[model samples]
Target: MTGGVRDKDRDAARDDTLRRFLLPIGAVIGLAIVVFGTAFLYDKNGAENLLAGIYQLLGNNAGATALRNGGGDQFVAKLVLAAMALLVGVGGVWLLYTGVSAVVGLLSLRKQQRIIPWVFVLPAITLLGIYLVYPTIATIYQSFTHGNNGAALANPLANYATLGTQDFPHVILNNVIWLVVATSGSVGLGLLIAGLVDRVKREALAKTFIFLPLAISLVGASVIWQFVYAYRPPGAPQYGLFNAIYTAAGGQPLDWVHTQPINTYLLIVIMVWLQTGFSMVILSAAIKGVSTEVVEAARLDGANERQLFFRVIVPMIKGSIITVATTVAIAVLKIFDIVYVMTGGRSGTDVIANRMYDEVFQFNQPGIGAALAVILLIAVLPVMYINLRNLRHQGVGA
Candidate 1:
């Protein structure tokens, strides 16, 4: 009887091991079926046939005929496609990860521990390589080539050479102006608002109102501001808010967006308005994180209010300030939507990104566009590096 019991226990262990291996295999096969099935259903020929079969099953009725003829079948097909996309996006990823992880579990304990992290991380790395790294390398290559055919240029630097002439210098200058003015305006106002609102009775309410514009898309903010800066001929009634206010105050109606050099500054105002809220929220949290004891110590040591703020508070949150400034500086470096929507980069308002877009898409000058893109990338990298270094010093992502 003891011998029989031992044999039965051995059999049970074998069966359990088999089940563990089979389960993951089954899951992978099931997921493959769903993926392929969805692809087939999404195909046009398969979709048409499926719709026809469904209509036939519903019987040859007037309602069925009308529905098929009225594009209801197409609408249904769209819904089916959308559903399949969602399933493949969410469900497919979950299923794949589950299967992959289960398979990894079948290995030795030490091996499993070593490999599981890569199993989870490999997909993200693959995606970044495909989407980001490939495009960057390709852009660099294209920047060295000539013309639409992508032939090797006799002088590889010719595209970059063009940047020194013909409005490009002004464009670069505008970007620099935006980087300085927009970054300073946003960070300065954000720091001020954050400091003031920290003492307010309804702090949340004040922050909400100031931060509201940040929620608006850059394009949407530009559209809203277009009306604010809108202009008609001098004799026509001023519809723009600025013009209306100016006319009321006995000043001449001025076109805010088209008034060169100044118009660029006006565009920068929209960025500052949108970004100040972000800066304010971040700086506010940093201020709150300052130790109350340290603040009290400074006050006790005969530090006045202004000195306490500038010397004590600002120094303590200097990391946060640097982070916000660098972050806003990067945004200003790549600014495009506001300039595009408001002035279409007209009248000396063009920045690097807008000019890149024009060269690549509108003007069919891909080489020049690629060169501009490389320059923009070069300009942004240092700011990003500084921000990352600061974050590291603060023990972020440690």
Candidate 2:
């Protein structure tokens, strides 16, 4: 009886092991069926046709006819494509990670421990290589080539040389101005607002109001500000908010966005407005994280409110301050939407990104566009390095 019991236990262990192995295999196969089935349906127009048939069966002949005519079909196709993409993207990753993890689980304990992290990380690394690394290298190579045909440049450095001439210098300067003014203004104002709001009774409400503008897209914000900066000629009723206020004070209604020198600054104001809230939220958290004991000690040591804030609070949150400044600086450097929508890079308000877009798409100067892209990448690298280093120093990702 004891011998039979031992044999039964051995058989049960074998069955349990088999179940663990079979279960993941079944899950993986099932996931593959769903993901691939979705793809197949989308590729063959089966999903769209089915939707159209449903519309017809529901007595919406017009909707069915629209679908047949490519309008509603396109919409249905898009929905299917989106669903397929999500399934393939998310489901594919899950399948890969889960399968690898299960395989690793079957290995020896030491081997599993050694291989598990790679099982988790290799997919991300592979994706980054495919998307980011390849495109970047290709762009750098393309920057040296002429036009869309990829012909060799007579002068390999011609594209870079072109940036130094004509209106490019002014555009570069505008980017620099944006970098300085927008970054400093956003960080400064955010810090100020964060400090003041921290002392207020209704902190969340005040922050909600200040943080609201950060929710607007740069394009949407530009569109809204277009009305605020909208200009009609002098002696006409000013429709713009700023111009209306100016004209009400008996001053001439001036074009805010089209006016040079000031126009760039006005554009910077929108960025500052959008970014200040982000800065405030980050700095506020940092400020709150500062030790109250240290603050009280500073007060006991004869530090006034201003001195305590500047010397104590500011220094404690210096990492956050740097992070916000660098983050805003990066955004300012890549600024295109505001300039593109508000002025179309006219009136001397162009920046690197907008110029790159015009060069590539509008002007069809692929070489110059690639060159500008490389230059922009070069500019952003240092700021990224600084931010990363600060994060490391703060023991993030340690």
**Of the candidates shown, which would achieve the greatest TM-score relative to the real structure?**
1
Question: What is candidate 2's lDDT per residue for 197-272, written digit by digit as tens?
Answer: 9898989999999899989999999988999999999978888999999899988889889888899999998998
On residues 123-234, what C-alpha lDDT tens digit does candidate 1 reach at each position?
9999999999999999989898865545567888899889999999999999999999999999999998999899989999999999999889999999999999998878
Off by over 4 Å in 1: 1-22, 37-75, 107-115, 384-398
Name the top lDDT candidate. 1
TM-score per model over all chains: 0.85, 0.84
Model 1 TM = 0.85
- RMSD vs true structure, all candidates: 4.4, 4.1
Q: How accurate is candidate 2 locally (lDDT)?
A: 0.86
What is candidate 2's CA lDDT for residue 243? 97
Clashes of each: 0, 0
What's the residue-level lDDT of 328 in candidate 1?
88
Query: What are the Cα lDDT values of the candidates?
Result: 0.87, 0.86
